[model samples]
Target: MLKSSLNIKVDRRDAKLVMAHFYVAFIALLVGGLAGLLQVLVRSGKFELPAGIGYYQILTVHGVVLGLVLTTFFIMGFQLAAVSKTAGTFTNKQRTIGWIGFWIMTIGTVAAAVMILLNEASVLYTFYAPLQAHFVFYLGLTLVVVGSWAVGTTIILKYAEWRRANPGQPSPLLTFMALVNTMMWTVATIGVAATVLIQLLPWSLGLVETVNVGVSRTLFWYFGHPLVYFWLLPAYMAWYVMIPKIIGGKIFSDSLARMSFILFLLFSIPVGFHHQLLEPGIDPAWKFLQVVLTFLVVIPSLMTAFSLFATFESYGRSQGATGLFGWLKKLPWKDARFTVPFIGMLAFIPAGAGGIVNASHQMNQVVHNTVWVTGHFHLTVATAVVLTFFGVSFWLVPHLTGRKLTKKMNKLALIQGYLWAIGMTFMSGAMHAAGLLGAPRRSSFSEYGGAAQAAEWIPYQIAQAVGGSILFIAIILMLYIFVNLAFFAPKGEEEFPVGEAANQTEKAPMVFENWKLWLGITVLLILFAYTIPFIDLIKNAPPGAQGYKLW
Candidate 1:
């Protein structure tokens, strides 16, 4: 199904372009991490900043940089590497287009970061309507998104070119995964594009007097949940295509792998309304429909878990391991590249469980707008996705730089992953506990002058602050690892791992490659799920809400 070697090499020009993307992503991680620490400190009532530095301003920076900027840049860089490694060399035209996309996104990030830092756009990453930002902020973010579209377009074009040249052959699994994600992202961004370009930008620029908050939120979530899948699929790509080879095993099932990726394309988009289960204006019937769709999306994740463990178990048995859990001990525990993603998988167990909780209609009411939701996403995006990115960076940076990954740097990376997992346990666990006691999320300060309900949250807040400090330290270590490898390590070429299917003669079913069918189904689901609800939102909307500069 997949070949172990594709005669791929990371050429100098491609390496530089990919590194450009990663460099920007790391800078975001550093700045965003600092802001996260500040948030924890201030919200815990354990520290105060200068009068001019507001908490919400810092929070906005944290969310936007980490959530939007870091993920986009990292995923772009990763996909480029994946496609380049698996498919073939990129043409000069494709490389040029990629760089153009990178610059556009960087410029937009700078513009938006400037606005957030100046406190002109403290609306947070969601940037829900009626809490309007400056027109520049909206325009800047729109460019960021549009820029990603350009990147995705280039990748798809590359894939299309490959398919044309090599008719009837299965695409490399890594390339296939990249193409699927690019397609998913192209669809996902439609809603956000509408939110920013049609609605928010016009409203913020005063081209419109007011905007409907309900409609804006719905549009945002339309992009938002699928945005989560966008973050996750790259990690899954690494898991399915890279992790098995890293741990001395082959992919468990090429057919199952393709099936999961296809399912994501089919089910990931229409389920955004599950995020709006607690919001108003959308009918309950529509919300229920989304909830069901959201659960349907879970099928791929469960399949993924099964395929991965099967790969590990096969490897473990090959090494003479006995009994059920004994295979875990036989697996690589010291390798940074493998352990980081493995930890991410472990974290996902809890995170996915919490997601199930969030999607439940009755359960959502209990935790809506609370720190519980915040904790759940942290375990997911921050821990599972971000940590996996960090893990991959261990070898990726060194590989592209023509440097050897030193033993010391590998150890540092493993330690960083451990620290992150430990700190999150304290932070996220406390957050979930406090949320059940009625603690709010997104509040700069929850003290409420010692109100009894707020008093109950103090200890958990303090735990969060402590956990945050440790996590910040972990980020610092991660930065050191990347910088040292990129600049200071001994020169050596490292191979990009591309695993073969366990049975090399077996091919993925042709249906998995029929992308047009999958995409059409995706669009139909989105329309069926959202079309009437969106019309109702706009037609029955209350008086439009005016912008408020709350900070």
Candidate 2:
């Protein structure tokens, strides 16, 4: 099935945009990773200095730059590329606008990055009400979002245009998912953007005496929940649609992939209030509603995991992988997508299985702001997003650079993947255990606490630092591998093979296109969520939010 060449045309300009997005995201992640490293060092008493205002400012810059800007922008560009090919669509004009959005967003990013480096705003990147800031941060984020909003429009218009010309055909499910994600971003992000523009700016300039804190967190998380999905969908797209194709198996259920995306669009936004479980003032009942919906959110994630694992099993059995677990031995461990995500998913199993326990009503009191929560996010985000990014990087690198990856380079990258998974497990495990023993999360340092708490964290902190170093070393090796692949490696002169998956394009089943089942599923979910914020006498709630307004 591996053909050396195929007729598919890769839009080189589009490919450049893809590279540009990652270059920014990866570098930003590196900066954020360093800030995280410092927090770890400070906690361990390994170093101390007048990090002072610079420390807090860097923390804000780190979160905004990496968690928001980098993740959003990169996924935006990648989705555009993936949708174009599968949908048999192209966007020459919109692609140009998309790149322009990239530049505008970039300028805003640089301006914001510089301002924070100078310690002008220490707002901690949260839109916490009454915590005002200088106008520059707000303005920079405005310009950035405006440009991205434009990019999103370009994507939607192109998809619509294609659908019109194609007559009565349904769009490729991914193209539909991309546009849904775009619409979600447009609708959801406006909540925060509105706060920054109308509310925060005017208030910071003393135009208003106060804004609503309860209102702010609610609107903010409405934006925040789907934002996680925005970062995540690109990874999930690869997982469901592309990975199976890449691995030489029919997707276990193309319908399931589409269903999952639809479920995400409906459910992801409402669940952000789960993070507000510990915060005062928000209605406890409303938070409980969100918590129930949040648990429902895990259902689709589980669906995707099973679908992918089943595909893995099929691929393995075909390769003569024997017995129940024997398929594990047969995976192309050298393939980045298969190997990295496989291990990352394995890492997630323990952490996520633990999360179900942690998310339970009573258990939340046990580990709410402790290292357990930290460990869970690491497993989900790192395993899901970052590992998938590595997988896609392998798929795209050679095509982008016009060189063959040396076998040695591929093996090196695979080795780095294993090292990453192993190191993350050990470090996160120690943190989770420490969380149970009363270690707090998000502290700049563990200094002010009592001996019992300090004693619990001492060993884990050291282990975490060691894990960080291992991860750093692995990243350094990847930089070397990419350098060789992009510049130093010999040009094959033989036309590069089309993506390994394109040749298997037999007609896919339309199992996902069925609407009635999804309609029923969505209705039931809405009922469950509606019940969340309601106060039945049978339901217990804490003060200030017990009598929540359901509508």
Candidate 3:
């Protein structure tokens, strides 16, 4: 099985499709990273825009380009490659669908990006109502979401084909994981689609005089929180399925991994109210119920952590390592692919802790609307998820390009990861500290008419600026490494690692393949958590506010 898996390469046509996504993702990194650096500089009170550009405009660029564009493109490309390698290369029809999806997404991204650059859509990445953007901006984002659905269709069709061919046997682990994430994403995107098509679009086009802020926000958060999980599950796939193979170890248990993913899908969507804990109009009972559901997500996260510890310890012991802490030393610290993503794993510890604090109503009150929330997501998405994607690129780009990751490139990759860690420690750490001291998020530098409290945050802002500069340097290094791997590395095959289970005799239960059961449960949970709150939002909502182009 291992030999056969290794021998099955992604088809040449499929590689072109994957690389198209990578090219766009890397370009976004450069643009977004520069914008981030500028943001920090301005907030530090040491710089000004040269061309009458608004600070929020660049902030929108930083958030939308990195948060939405880079993540979605890279994930779609990676999942496509994983499915092709594991399930079998795509049929010509499937590949054509993928290309079509790719072009639509690219066109949409270009439209949205141009609007932002023209200062027409300065509503930030959230695009919250009342602070409206151009009609094209809304249309562009809608197209992006629709395009992703099209891309996800290809993955679904391919998985169905695999199941049809295999009959009774479990689908490939990577392919199964891709399918779960794709389905979850499809379900989650419906909220955003509804908000754009039904609410924001009409309002922005002047067809509607008023828009309900509560319903719009409620719908956005419904899509927003799970959007975090959407970015995360792909990284989890690397952790559970690919990391073991990279480290010369076996997956701890196939059933445990699948069950954990199932748990994430079940718990992730029904818990968006946690983001609106500070908002009014929602009954406390509903908020509390959603908070409980949110806490349920921690169960699968812990399961993943436990499984990883077991995988590492088991692998270490097999190599004759001893002592409670000795297994740590046995890890492949020298390998960039292992070390980079391991750093991401470490970042998630604090990120998860911060998330718990944010979800708790009482604790959230203390940090609500503060830079601490900004710091929390930076650690979660930027450090944990983005770093893991970079780690994947170190090998993935080479594999798709028919090249090997050279020694020089690997060393540079290590430097890039560590630089990122150091930079984030400074930036996110300072943001958290200043937030505790009452620094507001989503605001530009200001003395606030000589307010005493604002003075306290300036030093931290300087530290953030320093850190952002460092992160930009790391981004440049990463881009260089990407270029080398794609065009300059030695021509050879690079393994696309897919680990086997530690116990071959134990098969994953056939019930896991029952998507009807899983999807039904997922829908039920979402409705149970959302239906009443949504109705309340619409039924008792205040007279809607007219759109404002604040920028």
RMSD of each: 2.1, 5.4, 2.0
Top-lDDT candidate index: 3
Backbone-clash count (model 1): 0
Candidate lDDT scores, in order, read 0.89, 0.67, 0.90
**Stretches > 4 Å off in candidate 2:** 1-7, 49-53, 125-127, 354-358, 449-452, 492-551
Residues 217-284 of candidate 2: C-alpha lDDT, one tens digit per residue: 65577677678778777777777776776667767765666667877867876676676677665567
lDDT of 3 by residue, 1-551 (tens): 32233235788888999999999999999999999999999889888887988899999999999999999999999999999988888889999989888888889899999999999999998988778889899888988888898889999999898887778888888988999999889999999999999988898888987777787888898899989999999999999988999988999999999999888888899888999998898999999999999999999999999998899999899888899978888899988999999999999999999999999999999999999999998999999999999999998998999999988899999999999999999999999998898888888875342678888888999999999999999999999999999999999999888899999998889899999999999999999998998888877776535322322
Model 3, global lDDT: 0.90
The predicted structure with the larger TM-score, 2 or 3, is 3
lDDT of 1 by residue, 1-96 (tens): 333336556777878888999999999999999999999999888688777898889999999999999999999999998888877778899988
Error of 2 at 226 (Å): 1.9
Clash count, predicted structure 3:
0
Runs of candidate 3 with Cα error greater than 4 angstroms are 1-7, 447-449, 544-551
Q: Score residue 532 of candidate 2 by CA lDDT.
A: 43
